[model samples]
Target: MNPLALSIAVGDYDRTRPLASGAVRIDGVDPLMIFLTPEEIFFRAFRSQDFDVCELSLSSYCVKMANGDSPYVGMPAFLSRAFRHNGLYVRTDRIKTPQDLKGKKVGVPEYQITANVWARAMLEEDYGVKPSDIRWVRGGVSQPGRPERVAVSLPADIHIEDAPEGTTISSLLAAGEIDGFMAQKVPALGPGGHPHVGRLFADPAETAKDYFSRTGLFPIMHLLGVRRTLVDKHPWLPTALLKAFTAAKELAVGALTETGTNKATLPFIEQSLEQARALMGNDFWPYGVDANRKTLDAFLHHHHAQGLSKRRLSVDELFHPSTYETFKS
Candidate 1:
């Protein structure tokens, strides 16, 4: 029989596509139900109610609320890795340092529940500049004649209207249309292509190390969560899925390495590996039991201190009960 239907909300399905098309026939898994983005999974979880299990980031307050003794519960995974929120890219001719960002307009997609918050935190903690220090702008995937809109919350800031995917943002930076923007390095077009624009942050590796040293909290970029009802009804679901995904991630790592380096995709793959190592160590186990608890506890304590949450939610309550027991042994 085919494996049960499961869904994950993340980037393109390149890694899993091959498995889905193969004859391996994932036991109790359904390849057709996978989702590519968190937004799609969120809407479907609430609307269609079709999915038996879903993946959500641990940092997301929405997932926390949804699992608050409700119908859904979170199954935290230590093996899962966090990706860096690629830093602000700017025109090399304009801004030289984070200090120069004062009064300049910066663009971000989601202000609140995004890697932007962590990126901003790093800037403030390291550079002593608060959010009020810069002109902020909000952009999205929808805009007239453009794939996204440029919406400014601050006054007198130049509007960096939506540009097409590859050339637009780079061109804007090159032409001085917008001061800077944040994006993943995967699709990064180096200064070679856009002459004037270059990365502002010097070394992401050192920055991440410093952030962890100071805060002892690693920001979670993605989380694999299992639904509560499913866990309660079928105790084996969480472990089974965890094992499957862990295996899949290993396969992905191998596939990535075998593909070698292409100018276009090398940066993304390298950065992803870096992130994976930071979050899960070199072993790349996507479902580590002990690591998840440590990371989750640290995150909850930090948020609680910031007055983000009232009290600490127990890991047992958040994750599958079986997971807790499995970790204890």
Candidate 2:
């Protein structure tokens, strides 16, 4: 038998580095990894429909994919610590409270992804600000001249573009290039909070809980999705992939805990724990079928409200229930 191949997509972040590492550890082969901006991932996926399986931010991707009229199936849940999408930060000096963001510029790489959308929703829902109230700027892959990339039905003003990742956004924030930005929570804080920067929203664990409570949505930080036809052809592929990833999550968690206080990887481990608490609450389970379904339903409803999709995506259309059942049973 040939070694099974799976293609995975994810943000270029250090925390997610374990996914690649775990792939090698388990399969003895490196999964096909595509590193790109969130926007590029969506465009590439929609245009070419390439790759047997791909990972993506769950909420935003669901909106875009469903809007494009593609019938792609997403994993029932995020891969453990991989689902923490509630990290949004801003310069503490500029935007002290969420309400202070009025007329200010907030940067995000892509709006179609959950980070931006959920952040916006939180500001509006929690803080009581209209999405159009802020000055949306698009920061491209580079720091200098990226403008906002607008979504189909989103308010025209609710978009901005900036440097590709949080590192650049962090730099821009430190230098006063941009007011605020959203990124992974653990990485948002460094030794002394970036000198010139202050955090506006640093409670990813809290945000995750609040999101689940308010919207019944578990913001998917990363997802493993297969093309519909490939799923139909290879029924076992999804199960095998999920099993490998779930095992990877466990190993990653164990490795982090065992290496506690090592100084080198302690921060990463701590951050992972924060994310785990957020996603799974006190008792964390990497694979929780009930929670996963609830999240899916929330995501579908959000997309529908935004007018991104005309119809609600059924659980069957979005995930392989059998995969979860097989794993649990």
lDDT of 2: 0.58
lDDT of 2 by residue, 161-205 (tens): 445444455456667777776644332334676854655757755
Best by TM-score: 2
lDDT for each candidate structure: 0.53, 0.58
Q: Which segments of model 2 are wrong by more than 4 Å?
A: 1-47, 80-94, 141-151, 155-178, 183-197, 202-218, 256-264, 267-285, 306-316, 327-329
1-329 in candidate 1: lDDT tens per residue? 54556554444454444445552334465655454566555445544544566655454543345345334555554323443534667667888988788778765554444355455655666787656677645444232132211111322322333354543443445567667766433224444557666667767666666666665555665555666766766677776665555556556656665536542355577677677677546755435546556655655554443333446555454566555444322
- For every model shown, the clashing-pair count is 7, 11
Score every model by TM-score: 0.64, 0.68
Error of 2 at 15 (Å): 9.6
**What is the number of residue pairs that collide in model 1?**
7
Which window of ten consecutive residues has the lowest lDDT sum in model 1? Answer: 143-152
Residue 304 lDDT in candidate 1: 40
Candidate 1 stretches with Cα past 4 Å from truth are 1-50, 61-72, 78-85, 141-178, 184-196, 205-219, 251-281, 284-286, 301-317, 325-329
